[model samples]
Target: MTKRDNASQSKQFSIYLRSTNEWIPVTKEQYKEHSKFYGSFRKKKQDHCKCTCPHQKWWFCNADCETCKYRTGGDTVSFDFMYFNAETAGITPLEFLESNVNDFTIDVDNKLISIEIIHYIQDVAPFILSVASMRLKGLTDTEIAKKLGMPRTTLLARVNKTADLIREKFPDYNV
Candidate 1:
């Protein structure tokens, strides 16, 4: 295949590793990983993509992907890049995205105070009282803890600490 064809084929698929919580765009070489398992179940005449999960089904296999015992237990919630920015600045993704990229002033002291996107994220996506809210929104303390590989209580404590800091920073915005 031409280099252009190869490159396009690579970006068409993605692999989500639950253990590391990383999603990598797949390539032809990596496609062999899926082929290893699928090859055993196929007839001699069938090619790689011709198989159910590889080409026909596109990553959905009742055994490995669907019927697998750990499917539900897996960390499949796609992490919002905005969430990370918000966490860093103590805010929400929507707030971060909506915030002014440049907070500048000429009339004041001429000093530039860079306002981090996290500040807006926190302001826009304030912490909710109900844990269920967090769970429903994919921000569960347990999930965060798992993502960070920490204890749930410890993660919750850290979240509370961040919330406290956000509250302290913005008195009017209660976290």
Candidate 2:
């Protein structure tokens, strides 16, 4: 694989949550807990592909491309991506873990908010809110869980649950 392929590998943990249909960043530790595929990331014959389908700058294809067999896409093709979720984080995961409970809302309409929506919400569980904030800052799940004095998987669950809440309450926010 080339540099771009390596970049894609780096983005594996970068998940697109079921709540928001956009790419969301997650900690490497969280990826390990929720998804168990990174350690097994070895080179394989079917690791890549080049399709001749109609697409623009990487918009969604009609489910007919075979560039890779990542989970984001179907078995018929090989393109994949990630998305993420949840409460508005005013402070940060590190801060929350350190006993800081500042809840700040990232404006729903802010253009940059879409990059990480969890940091821009209001009213949510403290743990989940902290997890989202830490994720926005690009910390791995393991790191957050460790600092917050919780198990890795537990943190993952909290983050996912928060994402579900966001999806249910603000479907129009495009978070």
lDDT of each: 0.51, 0.54
As a TM-score, model 2 comes out at: 0.30
Worst 10 residues of 1 by lDDT: 105-114
Per-candidate TM-scores read: 0.24, 0.30
Top model number, TM-score: 2
Q: Tell me the tens digit of each residue's lDDT in model 1 across 1-175.
A: 9999878755665665545556667776776776566455443213322333335543434234344332342222333533445346655554554553333233232222214325444564444234435577778677756766778987677567766766776575333
Once fitted onto the true fold, the runs of candidate 2 whose alpha carbons sit more than 4 angstroms away are 1-122
Clashes of each: 4, 14
Query: lDDT for model 2, on a 0 to 1 scale?
Result: 0.54
